[model samples]
Target: MGIKNRLKIMSFLQYFIWGSWLVTLGSYMINTLGFTGIEVGMVYSTKGIAAVIMPSLIGIVADKWIPANRLYIILHLICAGALYYAASVSDPTIMFWVLLVNAMAFMPTIALSNTISYTCLEKNNFDTVTSFPPIRVFGTIGFILAMWAISLFRFELSNMQLYIAAGASLVLALYSLTMPLVPTAKKKKNQNWVSMLGLDAFVLFKKPQMALFFVFAMLLGAVLQITNTFGNPFLHDFASNPAYTDSFVVKYPSILLSVSQIAEVAFILAIPFFLKKFGIKKVMLISMLAWTLRFGLFAFGDPSPFGFVLLMLSMIVYGCAFDFFNISGSIYIEKEVSSDIRASAQGLFMTMVNGVGAYVGSIASGKVVDYFTVDGMKDWQTIWLLFAAYAMLLGILFFFTFRYKHEPEKLANVGVKH
Candidate 1:
């Protein structure tokens, strides 16, 4: 009925569309479609590929021509069609193109959703710093719900997940038409090609501290994609072992994976205190260490007893590994970059983490998995340990290279402002 509620719905469906397919799509491809590791990685890498180009181009179109909300609706309509087609594809090549189209239509909407929400909230005189986080929390809830629905309904390895995502995309498309309109920005006479394309954000690289932060952001981005691409399949692979065949972890991997999302929500709430107490640099180091634990725990974890505890620990630490870098990094970038290129700078950050970084992570992770597979059986423990070693190496490098003194006063007022 109100603006906040409308924004909440938008946030919910925005992530729900992604959650329906993202976490379990690898499992579906691996178990049902019989796609190889490389094939599955190629499919998922479409998001990264699309993210590199589409979001900035779409942002320009939204700024100069279409209103954000209207463009948002249009993208969802196209995404709905793409997802429907993706559900019917049998060939990996065809599926790659289909998902790439879907990613192109869907990836830009994430930024558009935030733009729409910020505009509507400010227009209604709501303090976004205080109001937006609570509304955005619903997005994570929506993601978890989608995962639960797919798992509980036994659709985790079925094309039905894509259909569900397509249906939700269509619903969101229609619902978005009723949202508050966001006007496009008027064209400026002196704008250059770089500024128009949001490439002006690249200027942040001129600063040493900002440059280091983004480099590590890209590295961590790669780390993030590794789990998303393999975690479900890894769990499902446990069925090969007799002792774990009937275990709850194997039976309901998505529900178990949803623990990571739940942990994400809890960690997000604690970010403000962590920021005020530790500042960005230490918070980032903590995230790096958490990432090490996240992968290391998985290296020895199983579906039962003590090993299950390790698995649970991995899920819980995922929150810290993810939020401490991503959410906090965004906040840090906001503080570091100039406001004039702020939007573009944010776009650059996403491009690094979600675009190029994700692409590299997916492809490399696929190669690693394939390398560890002998006689069609994957050595998951070795694979996970290698990842853990990578994370630990990154932590050591970051500790020595990144230098930022704590400034609690600067962030004392920074409590989930995004």
Candidate 2:
């Protein structure tokens, strides 16, 4: 098989592992294992905690000691074991620790997979900018397919999702041995610990505009986490109502939630046009407003015919809410930062968003969810409206606080090059 095809398969399976459990696990924990919102949030927070520390440490190991492909294999192997053990865990505290081990093993593999892919592409003389996106899109497809598989097979509320993830992780680990070997970088005497750990990127905080952008990036990251952590459980809650018990939304919430992933693929194609026309500030503001709409629609949505329309709209807007800030923010960082710290800056962006932002969001959103629960029944409408209001407030603040002039010609080149 061609290298591109091989890498596509790798990308697919890499995310397939995550897709198996990420969306549905909340429902499983809540509905089957009888865990509370705070407990589930604490479990999910493992990903945030792992994202903060593991990637940088793992990057150092891959750069100086282990080949990226080899490290990827090792991480997936650990993930397979951790996830398999997680399936057998029933106690919330035990499950938290089990999933934390899994998260630590799994989170770094994301960056390692990218590193492996980039190395393979460059060695084969492929243009990473042009070639990588198509290959990466398969990962999203893998995610959607996994969600559908869990829902269709009635594994959404079972431990089978974790087993499936564990099996996939094992397969990917074995398959990774076949990929082209990525060589480690030789240690440089001049490299400082701050540079190695990506702490040098913190210098961007000195610039007021960049500092404000990072802050908002972290806030938006929290929104993303809130959706991921609760969206499935929210839809699954509809099954409690006899009137909506037979509806497709209740019968297969993950499949319906997969629409958000499908929409994500479509919206990514629209980003260049939006960025070119509106610039980063306006594009980001649109993202914030889309997030507001996403939550507000969910606030009113249900399994009823008309309410179902609102549910579908929420799914559609998720693509805009997600990709606009994430991809656009990366581009903004690329354009603004110097070449020396560019890579570090990107790493810091992820740390702020996925690490700190996700941790805070998970914990805070969990508390919010619990606050609205009485007699074991949740006030989902009020919960969603409060989230919507938060997004709207962020939009308002971001509009006034962030200042950047749009230069069409400068960004035009970035669009053309990508």
Candidate 3:
């Protein structure tokens, strides 16, 4: 097979494995396994924790010691083992640790997938800017297909989802081995250990705006895993409400949530326009406003078709909520920072958003849920409202802190960032 075909298959499988369970795991945890909010949050946060530290480390090793393709295969193999073990678990405590192991192996691969793609495309002399997003969108398509497969196969609420994930992961792992090898090019003779490690991204914290951007990035990062933790189960919970059982939203919860991924693709296409017109700060403010609406919509949505529509709108808004801030802000940082530290700065943002931000959101949300528990009922509305309020407050803060005015010439000159 040609390199492009190999990469396309690998990309498809990368997200297909994740989509098999990512959107529906909360439902499985709560509706099937009866795990509480905290446990569910922790399960989701494992992704964040993995997102925090591993991507950069893996990137460094890929840039230094190991070939990206080789590392990618190794991580997937490790992930396969942990995922199989996780699927067989009956206990939450053991499940947490097992999930953590799977998370570490899998999380870094997301970024690594990007690295591999860029390297392959560059090696083959393809224009990444014009060509890559279309290819990347296939990953989202694969993700949606996997979600449908899991739900349709009735694997959504079972350990079978993990089996599905493991199968896809193994395919990805094995397929990755056949892809063109991306060997680390020695950058400089006797590279400094710290420089080689890409630890320099930490220096971005010195700038006041960088610090604030990351702080809010972490704060908003709280929202990152919330839907993944409760969204499907939230709709499934309507099954208990009688009025919502026959509802399309309840019956087709995964499809309802899949709209978010659909919206993500749309939002991504709109980004260049939005960035050119509004600048990153305003665009991020838009993200905060969009997020405030996302959770708030869920608090009031139902399981019926109309409810599903409302949920779909919530999903549609998710594109703006996610793509605007994360992708756009990274580009903004890339425009401002030097190339040598650029990779590290991107890693730092991921650490803040996925790591510290995710940790805070999960732990805090868990506490909020536990506190709201009374007589075996969770105050779901209150929890969502609190989140919405927090996002609103964050929007207000970001508006004041991040100062930028759109200059078309400058934006046109702006380069591609991670």
lDDT of 3 by residue, 36-66 (tens): 8667766777887887878677766776678
- What does candidate 3 score on TM? 0.86
TM-score ranking, high to low = 1, 3, 2
Better of 1 and 2 by TM-score: 1
Per-model tally of clashing residue pairs: 0, 0, 1
What digit string (tens of lDDT, one per residue) describes model 1 on residues 1-418? 9999989999999999999999888778888999987798788879999988877677666666678789899999999999998898878999999999999999888767766776687678665444656677778889999988888898978999999999999999999989977876655789888667656667678878889988998899899989888888789899999999999998888888899988988887777778778888888889988988998899999988999999999999998899888877766765565444434555667777888789888878889999999998999999999999998898899889988988766553332232
Query: Regarding lDDT, does 2 or 3 come out ahead?
Result: 2
| lDDT, candidate 2, 221-296, per-residue tens | 8999899878977998998999998999987777888899888777766777787788999999999999999999
Q: Could you tell me how far off, in angstroms, the CA of residue 106 lies in candidate 1 after the best superposition?
A: 1.0
lDDT of each: 0.83, 0.83, 0.75
Q: What TM-score would each prediction reach against the true structure?
A: 0.89, 0.85, 0.86
Superposed on all Cα atoms, model 2 deviates from the true structure by an RMSD in Å of 3.4
- List ranges where model 3 is wrong by over 4 Å: 1-8, 26-42, 120-130, 178-185, 189-193, 304-308, 330-343, 405-418
